[model samples]
Target: MQSAIPVSSVWRRPVSPLHCRCEEGDLDLVVIGAGYQGLSTALHAARAGLSVQVIEAGGIGDGASGVNGGQVIPGLKQDPETLLALFGDEAGRRLIEFSAGTADFVFDLIAREGLDVEHTRSGWIQAAHTETAMQAAVQRNRQWRAQGADVALLNPAEIALLTGAEGYRGGFLDRRAGVVNPLALVHELARIATEAGAALLLNDAATSLQREGTFWQVSTRSGRSFRARKVLVATNAYSEGLVPNLARSLVWLHSFQIATEPLPPDFDFILPSGQAVSDSRRIVLYYRRSADGRLVFGGRAPMRVPQSTDDWLHLERAMRRLFPMLGSMRIEQRWFGRVAMTPDYMPHLHEPQPGLLMAAGCQGRGIGLMVALGGVLARYLAEGSREALPLPISPLVPIPLHRFRRLGVAAHLAWYRLLDGLER
Candidate 1:
């Protein structure tokens, strides 16, 4: 299918360095992947007066960054309490503060860059499908408010009024959360980075890397090489086997989305609140109303491996179950993407090798976390401080039974689907 938006109109050409030609000996930094993380890092480094270059195997935002659910939800996928238990109070608070600042950072960046990506702060609703889930939602809202967040608990009647659906028992609303045209945001960031004097190379894939004394020589498939003092692997899920040690450490899960055609204006009453919504299931279903009044829904579907043509009948069924008002609406688009997940479900930055840094394993919270991580990486590069980073940099450890990841993911999906059905 053709892109809804033109590619050329979305991304601009990168700016070539004037003083240092392409044949110059080395650059200050070479970022792999043109997704949000890489582009943000390139922008930050170039803004810091460093010669930076970004290489992407495909077009900008061709990966998960562009194809996600587009719900700019706050906090990590795993609960903040779980994080505290795992890393102790101090580190956990640092992680929570960094993550919670993600939404603020995104809104601030849009304002600062003047990007027209259709960003809105209409808020997000975390609904409960069961009584236990409802209690969890209320508790989460209370905890977030205690931590100084602007959040409110919605009773059953409030939920019905906000969602126009009787399925949700209760929920909470966070006005700081919102949605965006993710592809548009990525494209705007790429443009802003280029305008800020950063070089971004599309269709240039990093094939291999070698440490050249105090510098790094990164080779690309297009018979090109970049010599940089430091290299950041912000490839995320599309790392393409570059770092075998890292590839084995994380579990990549496939998440799929389906967007319906813009509904009639009469249907606006169904989602008058314009709040993005998500449930608390293990394989949760998250959805939001688009600026043009389309319902974009997404969730984890049963999949043995990552493939474009995997059947989406399950997602369609789920959509019908949640909002039967659009049962007859045609699906305008369906897409899938893989998100890097850690056992602890937290994003991590790894110093796999000195001078060569890797930051990924964002789970499903990559959008905001990636931006925050980029800013942190920029600060770390500018100053000799890892303290600026939101998440801790730890040693890479391969997921157990790495070779059977596909089977493991399939089993996990089946179990979650079964659990969702049982709960219903």
Candidate 2:
């Protein structure tokens, strides 16, 4: 309802070059990758009085963190019931509670840091694409409500009223969910982390990691090296040969999104609540309106980086199918990013060995969860208490026949599309 903060002010801020006086021995932590996880962990670790340094192959937020759909939904990619089934009652209950509070944690961080990212806590809608899906939404509403979540099922009438579209049979709404300028948030986090006495090294790709005496030695492509007591590999899907068996442990898929030009002045009653919407399809369709009134529509794409606007044509078609009025809208921007997926569709925290920690496989819900996990990691590093973590530490389980993962992912995508078409 209110105009967003000037994007130029947030997105155009310059990143200062890395000036590290700590050399190698004095560094307490060396975090790889400068996306949400790395920045969040750096911020919390620095706040806890650790000498932290973050190394990014590209600029900050140059990974999925910058190009995400920006929907701040709680919980993991797997639903509550599934979590309970995967983990037992106690662990699953803890995870469910943590998931429920993810949005609150993110919003509070944004406020405490005085971040200018366009944050809106209007709500989020999990639209049901089929009758069976709507029934499942009811079940989810009941499950989460029983677990103390403020969620509700919306019938078709309410769905139409909320989304301004008749394609969805029904949906579930979570009031805690919202959206933000993801890139802006990333920049602000990096800024605050550095301001609180952390070093950020951009264009410094980690070339090799080794154990040198008591500290972990991390060598960079720029020929600089840092040795720290602890090392965290937070590079999710973009981890190209940085860590052994890291990229192979999860399925990497491409997600593309396109933004429309600002709607006409007369346009109204379309997502008037200003909430984000995601539907119940294996290859899901998610969208939300930008602060400037452009509808940002996004969904799954082929497993390749998009080269031009034409690569987003399928996304545009998907948007038109949901809201025919958008058929004639002009496309203003197109982009794609890789998202990681675990076998169980849950974010994994791995401790392959002591002094080495890795967190990845956000499975498309990384915005809030990554921030919260960062805090958990900080606590673990500071207090050395793994029992206090919401997520249990597990060994990295690399996918079988890892080299054929691309072909496997393609087949899975085709199967999901077939299933979605049948439901429609």
Candidate 3:
């Protein structure tokens, strides 16, 4: 007998969130935040035979890592030539190599770990919204291909046929990229991390960090104090007071998504290629097909949480504009998550105090980058070497006038929208 209540496509077995402490004195590492970076770090550290622990403020899948649209895109906001010019020959080449392989790295890990996250490495699209955008895509495809990446160019006809969307001039596709069940990935990581001897404490926020003798002491909201030889602070746009203005350093923006219930069988042609897409617009449009055949569409949202339906009307309009076959599909889910964007659109590694390390700035490309970074971080932590890290360690510098970012972001979004219209 079918139950009256509808079940979600992705099955959930929530982790038992309880207050737990590390095992005994002077642990090797105490990680704050249980997002991809923290989980990856703990898993790798534990596998390496290091004593480690994780402290999460909320339940798993509460941050950007879990709630995202699951697009595993590789590369940074900068192109190869620009990166080379900015950071010279050696460093730029290293950064390029690291960014290019993030997606493959993530897919390999999923297979290697036997993670239950449903995923594919079919490809990822960068739809060109304008002729100029097409030219840029062409250049990007050429650059990556020359570096031995499996990338290709698509014509207007190919773009329209592949995406089932209107008004795309051309595009680029990276065959190494793909999509995943984001929350499922996080849950599996948590499960495996705990099984590997990394203690995970959920709902226990790290409220304070201070040095106690040689070890760094982390004080939690539950009045529990943990001491460790090192600390990893994973920044996911929700960081705050624990580390002195760490939150202000990022430009936090909201990216929201709406998903339809499993569509009728005939709608399979909508994204028949089974590749996730993000277009080349100032305010980008990204969408994908879920494992259960729902259309999971997403785009720029208000800087804050939605207070009314008006905040999401733009997505519906855009969806209908792209794929007009559906007159009125009922949206089964509407959700949003905060993204920490850097002004330069590059990832940063910081060491604010002795024995404390942190990473910031995902810029909407967090999925694969953050996961791949885990091995980098784990190796660095285990062996005490900085040679493999892409970004140099630096002090956390707050973004200037972060208090006024609300007004600036709102105004800029409006202006960018107007500019997008003018381009057409």
Candidate 4:
């Protein structure tokens, strides 16, 4: 009735990564990292006729951008009421409004750029694994709908009808949520940026950064140096020793995904509407149909960095449990990526020094949120005013005893898993 196949593999991107030859020149902005955020910044900056250059350690979308679940869900990691309570009324409202439209912003960008990424706006289902969890989904629908979000509470039957899965109790559907090929999306943005005169260099990592008078000098591992008036560090979960105390400020967690071979054409009832779906649990479970009819499913990774497909046995078991119809469907691929989680489970914009801007700690909700934040950061840089930003800029605060983050995360996962089991 179930399988434990561990065929670790990488998703072959539609296009090869760009390898632009760097030139010796200064730029208006230097974006470090070619993920969604950095490339998005480059796109907006290049569109405004600014000299932009993006430096990436590996190929474009080599990091989490290539391996993410690709669910274009809206809002921050925290709920609306929680954000409202933490940030107060006016600022909270602004943050809610901005975050709610992140998916819309992404789809809009795709249509505007005529990018051929396999994107769909068939809505997103947040399924509840338990009746108790369904109550929370009800609250979420109320909170989001009050902010003008097109969300509705779904009964258990509705959940089953929408997802083709019977185990879920109930949940909510956000009309704006969707999915896309993250690799394709990032590559398209990179193409747009380069065509708009922005320089993008892959296989290049910013080794060191220093400020001199009014400009910042960035040295790459390939021995090339570039100077820029403004520096934007968008290297989220992959920020390993890139900047002082940057990596230490966030807890890095591993998220893994597994894909099944294309379901038989006759099995059309499974996610028939083609909407992306995720369950409401501390360790989130998400799945969607690929353009080729495969089921791209994902969930939490092991406490440690996952090495092989076998390391994602939990996800395999979860998938089989939810959809028993796949009695022996072969798992075609397995991959994992790191997610930068802030203590508060929210994104942070840091301006630790003048002319330097760093944004990170997405807490596993990056797809749409990353692009939205990138646009906001680009505008803030051009306007040279923090007042123009939807979220306030804050100083970097490194977590105390950050060396034990891995152990702490292990404990956190254990507790969350325990709670999830009890609730279920």
Candidate 5:
């Protein structure tokens, strides 16, 4: 469906020039998917003097990158202690450091590129919905603090004052987190990438890929093709059969969002810290204040696949549970996007085939992670070693009975919803 908002309203810059044509013959790199990862990779590679060409199935940021809730949160989905237990201390520390740097890298890029996207570094809070969760938040704060993260464990009074809600028992606040206008950021990045000499081809889907001696031949449905020495698949959830190996390795789940009309000025008293807040639940609720004074909230909803519907009554009810004062607020916009989730919740960068790299499975945190992944992929493409990646790159392995992922996700969501109800 066409958006009611004008394109220029959300995107500040002009379309990238590379979205037009594909050059003849071979290129240094061909990137699939024009989301944040793809755009960032192209920008960094081209700026480093490589001939880069990016192909997108749809318009720039039309995928999850543009449709996300725009929370620029830090760290990976997996807990650091769990990572250390699984991969040992050294690898776990490396993983934590890499994920944390994602937010820093994003802010640095915004400043260096001088993009007009509304970025705010007001920090983020993880609110506890139950006593058990509150204890966990305290432990998490301690862990993060030991790792040099500027995190604090807030008391119930502080939580109530910060969130403007009495529902949360307590929580942890991290100053390293923030928010952004994701779509605008992607558009600006695409423009900057083109300015740096990278070619971006929107509406050009990479239909197939095959190895041609040392190079990879990537062909699009529009009869356009790119013979590149290196190809990076940054498609995320919209990978859509581009690489069978990589596709099978990840499961797709839909995350839905609804934004309220510009918040009343008095709402500031509720969020005195002016930070983004998310509840600690399996079916988590993440919400933040937009630069325009709107409350944008989102969470996982039961859906068979990626589809948008205006029937967001369930999500609105969920929002009201957090902020009863917003019960009368009108939902100005409703949207949904698919996220690629791995079995272990950790993102993977894989060399599914020789000379072809696949980076996906950011779960629902791709905004910050994708930029970091781009830097990792660029280094790998230039150096010819996955070892250069800050995070580990393991072989792609699909979840057992992967074809039934939707059923599994639906059942999980149902259980989580029940838990949320019980807690309430």
Candidate 6:
């Protein structure tokens, strides 16, 4: 296994600051947020001959796009059968096909861009935490297999061999899924977008957005204004209050992860096949072996932004439960990222107003979904074809009483944790 470059260190990797005029001007698209979606959309849109400008409140990928678990898991939380049943044929099939190809699209982009980074496509394992979960995996396997996905069910013995964890009963693997240093990919995407002629305004946040005449005028906190024909709010989980329509559309949660100090022998024991492993618990825990020989272990975290490392120690108990040998290992990295969840556990594309597009809720699979969706958005914007979109542009209704969402999520996580513990 290759060594994973320290994720924290990547934050300091010198991406040249935008040397050109930082002024806001006429543009085809003014994308808010420089995470995966914004960078990808900006890259594609610029290539498609659209004048693009991206505004970021902080450094690129400073949000979940860089800090996430980096597991390139595919599809929505819903299984193929459920998707078909819930969405019906046309929309369901489109969703299924779009999701199935997300992982491929991400890896393809990495390759096409000639990104020199450590990545693997060995597979992704959904290690079942209980017999019921194993049964669920079996059904998912059957459904996805029937849909021509390269998937298979793994028995307990196979699960142990693959995950190197003891508690999992069994699970299934998706060969199409994998892992990569997300920060590497996203930071590189920023470079690619810049090279493609997209203006990147780092450390600048969009404050207000309004329609004036034919163009949308986006005012930044730094007193810069950009007029664009279209706008995309790709902030995802980090959507604070720049636009209430997008900020209130989804629920936000935090996912924290800890990395062991270059556990090489542990890597030999855990996830030797290079497959990222995530359990089937409702409050799911996911782990992957980084190229730097670190085991990135993570699950649910505080519903709100963590105050410090004290907020992350809660995971040690669960970590030792799965791999008790880790009980004595030194944790070198502790971090958490924001997660956006929709009520339906599916991604949403909202057109709250004309020429203003919003995308949210990849339900933790944003890496692959956003990467692919970027191209789709680019094509759609380039051709003005709404019918070609796999996702429907639905109405923007703010989740009711979103101010109390944190308390509600904390309660739900507690209940789910109790239920998950009972199964164990």
lDDT of each: 0.78, 0.83, 0.84, 0.83, 0.80, 0.84
Single out the weakest 10-residue window by summed lDDT for candidate 5.
4-13
Across residues 221-315, which tens digit of lDDT does each residue of candidate 2 receive? 97888989899999988877767788888888888788888887656678998989999998999998888888888899888655555767878
lDDT of 3 by residue, 303-380 (tens): 867766567789988888888887788887777778888878888898877778889899777988888898788888
Global fold similarity of model 6 (TM-score): 0.94
Clashing pairs in 6: 2-291, 3-291, 3-292, 4-291, 4-292
lDDT of 2: 0.83
Model 5, 1-424: lDDT tens digits are: 2433322222233343434556667799999988989988888888778899889888877788887877777887766787788788887778888887788889888898788788888788889989999999977887888888878998889888887876888998988888888888888888888888888788878999999898999998989878999899988787777787677788887777787888888788667667888888878888877677777788886555433444456778888987898768888777777788888888887887787887888866788899867887787787777566776767877778878877887888888889888998
- Give RMSD (Å) of candidate 6 vs. truth: 3.7
Give a tens-digit lDDT track for model 4, residues 249-338.
Answer: 888877788889999987788999889998888888889988888888887766566555568778888888888898899988877777
- Among all windows of 10 consecutive residues in model 2, the one with the lowest summed lDDT is 1-10
Of models 1 and 6, which has the larger TM-score? 6
Residue 181, model 6: lDDT of 86
What TM-score should be assigned to candidate 3? 0.95
Which clashing pairs does model 3 show? none
- List candidate 5 stretches off by more than 4 Å: 1-19, 305-310
The residue pairs found clashing in candidate 1 are none
How do the predictions measure up, each by TM-score? 0.92, 0.94, 0.95, 0.95, 0.94, 0.94
lDDT per residue for candidate 6 within 1-424, as digits (tens), equals 0122332422223344443335345888988888888888989999999999889988766788888888898887899889989889998999899899999999998898887556899989999988898999999999999999999999999999887788788999999999988877888888888988988888888999999988899998888889999999998887877776677788988888888888756359788889998899989889888878878889987775666567777687788889886769888877777889998888888877788888899787888999889989888877879866888888877898888888888899999988988899
- Count: clashes, candidate 2: 0
Candidate 1 C-alpha lDDT tens digits along 123-162: 8898888899988887788778877888998888998888
Top candidate (lDDT): 3
Q: What is the C-alpha RMSD of each candidate to the true structure, in Å?
A: 3.8, 4.4, 3.8, 3.1, 2.7, 3.7
